[model samples]
Target: MHQIKRRSFLAATGAVLISPRLTAQPAEASQPGSLGASVTIEREPLHALPRTQYGHFLEHLGRCIKGGVWAEGESEDMFLGGIRRELLAEMRAVKPALIRYPGGCFADGYHWRDGIGPRSQRPLRKNLAWSRLGQKLGPEEDNHFGTDEFLRLCEELGAEPQLTANVGSGTAAEAAAWVEYTNGPKDSKWGSERVKNGHPEPYQVKYWFIGNEILGWHELGWQKPVQYVETLKRYAQAMRRVDPGIKLLASGTFGPNPNHAEIHQTLLQGAGDHFDYLSVHLYATEWVAPRNLWRYQILNRQRRPSRGLYYEIMAALSVQQQYLEDCISDLRQFSPAGKPIKLSFDEWNLWYRGYSDLYQSNFNLRDGLWVASALNLHHRYAQELELANISQMVNCLGLIVSTNQGTFPTASALVFRIYTENVGDELLPSQVDGPALPHPTGLPVLDVSATRQGDTLALFLVNRHLDAEVSSRCTCQGLQVGTVAKRVELHHPDAFKYNTYADPRALRISERSETLKVESDGAASRFSVQLPAHSLTCLVLEAKNL
Candidate 1:
């Protein structure tokens, strides 16, 4: 069980030979100090900051399901049959609050009966784990966009469809008849094959991540956390004997693999009461090669993009927010607080696979300010993030990018459509005395987050200075600001500028509406904005209380 096959092929081909180097540092400019933010509008609330943490992953690998969100032999006009009405209007403009499906490591060699009925009677095979990580559309797959075309693109992006079952070459009765063919009902038995394939309600797919990254031996059921905790309690008791209100996530990891915390303490002492979410899978890569790895990714392939790969992926957002704050303190020291388990950043972004191509991504503006500073640490650890996708949405490392002449939106999907159009509802509490990046835990140069709702608030900034501008300031205590309704910016002076199909508004999303000069001094309300130098902002202020 020494499955360290070159750290599972450099964490499944984001081929890195070690990084934070495409070379070119110093000159990220602004560091002459002084740049603050003190938010703290607390009337009582610290948990839950979810927009499912801005979710969005959909894998069938590269061209993320042939030609980005399916539509192969071309045929658009009112879509849905080929589901690419511009990838459903840029995934209903990044309002996605969960969409993982069919796979990453192709859901343990998927086989929900070769993708449920009609699509000219499916059955073509060969797309085994992205045709062995190369997937040039060859490596066949006529299982045309299967599973009722991925729940009709999550029922046209209202979202929530997580579903990644197929623990390495399937079965607990074929993943419990694919959770009774998507949340069973109509006279059971695979829900009467989803009411004979034409869907009769029940797409009740409330998430299910069972296996993907099965303790990586380049996964395909790469067991070891004590035989994947009894094959995850025989596939969670045969998919809860066909749906016990779904949920489940499991395939977790929190390590540099020294038995990664004894494989998360043997999946929380063997299948921690079945599961509610653990599904980790990060990617802000490294480990380049002690082995060939496809000739060191075709002999060092990384011909562009720098600021040392944008401060080594914005210092891997403070090294994956200290590996998800030590994975929420290893889920409060290994579960059992009456069966709790949340944290499903079900696959993040920024890969290397030696400068991707087959996993297509040219995403920039420093990968949209590293996805708006990784959603300001998922809105400051949004109550242990039950789900947080974004591994793919269209092209492979997507946020919307596809070419043969269409689809755009990647300044990391317009910083996820300006944080899903400013989602707020409490989770506020900010404190920043900025101008950082001198390591040893100092990454800030103004990365922040604050949310509210009634009386609006929703701040969310990220100005990692490439040539200085910050000056910022937002003191606010317990709220009271009164005007400045929206800002939404996704600046670009080219941190490897993106948005192409011959310039899809060459780096768009500018939005405006200003007015915030508040100055109360009765111990709170203060404001002063001006952050732009490799930006990504979002204001919204019009507060209350005080």
Candidate 2:
């Protein structure tokens, strides 16, 4: 819909705003989609780009917790408390910034208490949301991987824990007590229970969201705006009473809907001063846009195997960004000026091959490109968007898929390695200039974002086009660069070939320092690289101001 509107406006105007960088010379235009692109970067930093933006979401659904993080039964590479040593070791390799846990829709029905006590004694409950409302095709919630184990995992990986409170089937007091149990003194009721559970020290977990998706009908206790705000307010009040220092995120929109504006309006008009952040969840795993997303999420099947599905999925990044843009726009309209709520994309990923066995979907190099490019898109809005968690850290919609046998890093996991290793906290504002692809809308074939820390400048670029390689010319506008220190590219000829434990090289990162050519033009330092189709490139350069 956003794309249609964008294209219609472009068609009506008889011109697409090429942003000065996207337009090419007539001589360069002779080749099919030959885009003479440049990355004109400014010297000054935008702001502190939060590492939390590259956070992860680990749910209680399917093998995401069971076989994904915790070894299902018994394994030699197991950590102290059934946590897989290799899984955590691999996770640490990519550098998980923050981890949201226990639920997606599962949060609504999840009772944190059942999972906290003795693993053997802990009660087995219905896997409500993830298992089709407790019909129980697979095993029920075994309570093997619970609160303390989760925090232990967090401590192991050095990642912050962001727990979602159950508002769907639980009370405000329950939410607050969970906070107290984690962060309160041992003398307190729930905190004493935590001590009894063998943890004497407080975890001091800082991030807590109200619920997963309470606004949607699929949730256990879906509340309308008028009622939902009061529910949020009550939960916030209770939880904050326990730990005033804790940050909170409210359950937010799933996608662009007609109800989007009004819902935000009512949420703010009612609980304007309550939440620290408004949440958002989006995915490009689907091929076509659904008329009814709530139903579509459940239907869980690809409708469009159109010849252009790859491009459509790639182009959906703009739609995802636009969703945030519109959500924030609506938020600003009704939100308090002084205490403005930020954004938290707590649940998001590429998940379309709907479940049969453990919800493991199909993937290829295309998904990897989408993940890297999607991060690039998020980098552009890093100022307003503080945190985003790619859904399912392990199996369900995970970047790292594992089992009792062994584990292998998915193509998407490699994307995190490039960013976590090279991408910095300081955002170096950049623009990608290239040819426009007009299908759903006019969008550039090249996607990019830049950042610098200390002397190293990292350029994260993606050639979203499927066929042709983009010859990209880059320059730092107000600064001079010293040398092309490092160049890494993720590319493969086939989009569908994947890596297993036996053969993990089908999708991998290439360290090609020769691909980057550096030359000085008077005062400006310029570098050029041939970006291949369906590729993610990171150029780490030694940079200095002239």
Candidate 3:
């Protein structure tokens, strides 16, 4: 039988104590995949921007809150060392610019003070929205993991905090006080309390969400458009007076649907001017029949259509973009000079298909592919979107799964790691001019992101082809290439193979120089590369003057 243990093994000691078994995994399976020929990456002049809109969310539901990040009992590790280690690892992987917490639907009823101070002394409150017990889990949970803990974690993870304020079942004062507690330093009682709790420095987190999913059909029944707009306006104005430098995100409906559009329009008309960003939520799933598998074989038999995972991928993204465009258009109709507000997809992931329901399901191949596709979609649209959190990053709908006792990286986590590592500060321009791969259902041949590091051109390619490898050329004008440096890939024959503590390398990056080739200087000198079926490739080229 396999065994697991935890000791004071220090990778970055004093900072945190992660378990040893957590990082150990079996050897990667042998690689014998075919590497055919040389390919050229055409020289292109690039004007790219930082992908700041890349953000993440952490919720207090499922394994996310209890066993995922915080351990209640007194252990040598104050903040649950194991969970801290897992969080650090995930943060390193996703490289998220911002981290939103204590929510999804949980934020509406969240009390900031309930999860602080002494763990046992904190009272357990009713979590009406996302409790697994259908009632309070215990006497009332101590506020062991509260604002201080979240900000501390954010600081440790090198991410900006995106605090969600309470709107329903909470007054404007409680919300404003929270902003003060985090941003305010030791000039007042709350600030003193923050210092007394071990961190003397003010967090000064800049992004705040007024509330979450207020437009959902069965939300706490807080308000209709006019009321929501009024409440949000009051909350934003009051909170801004407390800390004017902070950016407030006014919640918007995810719509085109009647319910979403009505509330969306109302919120825009009511409080659009007082905010820095517009928040929206979207998750794609196939909750039925041939779409969702029989649970048992889900890790194996599941396969996305040759074209794409779901028809709704394009539809959902299109709808969200359209919604934001229309909302902004409506806003500009009145205040043409109003500050532009981009989309913050703070909550999104591959849900439905019972995949979301299987909280502890190991990261297998199918999940990894979906995660890769979703992130690719985000990179493609990064110009308009400001923040995209891969909803619930640990335990529940997580990129990594952990119990207070231990943790395991999932396929989804690997996808985030691969994507974040390859794409850099400059999002370069690229054209996937190959013949579009067609299926009974529509599917594009390639999913691509081009970026430049100095004069070196880097391309992140996701080939969604099921059978045939896609052969294509990238032509960039007014630049010269010296040599093709390296071509690396993350691929496996079984798209669902997962990394377990026992075998972590099941789906990892492999390097092969033979898979790429370059021919220099001419219209016919365009760089050509064959994107393997269902694989992700990163190609880099060094520049040379012609």
lDDT, ranked from best to worst: 2, 1, 3
All candidates' TM-scores?
A: 0.34, 0.88, 0.81
TM for candidate 1 is: 0.34
Best TM-score among the predictions, by candidate number: 2
| Residue-level lDDT for 89 in candidate 1 | 81
| Ranking 1 against 3 by lDDT, winner | 1
- Of the candidates shown, which would achieve the greatest lDDT relative to the real structure? 2
Tens-digit lDDT track for model 2 on 1-41? Answer: 01223212112211111121211111121233455688788
Backbone-clash count (model 1) = 4
Cα displacement (angstroms), candidate 3, residue 302, comes to 5.5
lDDT of each: 0.72, 0.75, 0.60
* Pairs with steric clashes in candidate 1: 14-353, 15-353, 16-288, 17-288
Using TM-score as the yardstick, the better of models 2 and 3 is 2
Q: For residues 489-526, what per-residue lDDT tens digits would candidate 3 score against the true structure?
A: 87777654667666656677777664335554554335
| lDDT measured at residue 534 in model 2 versus the true structure, 0 to 100 | 70
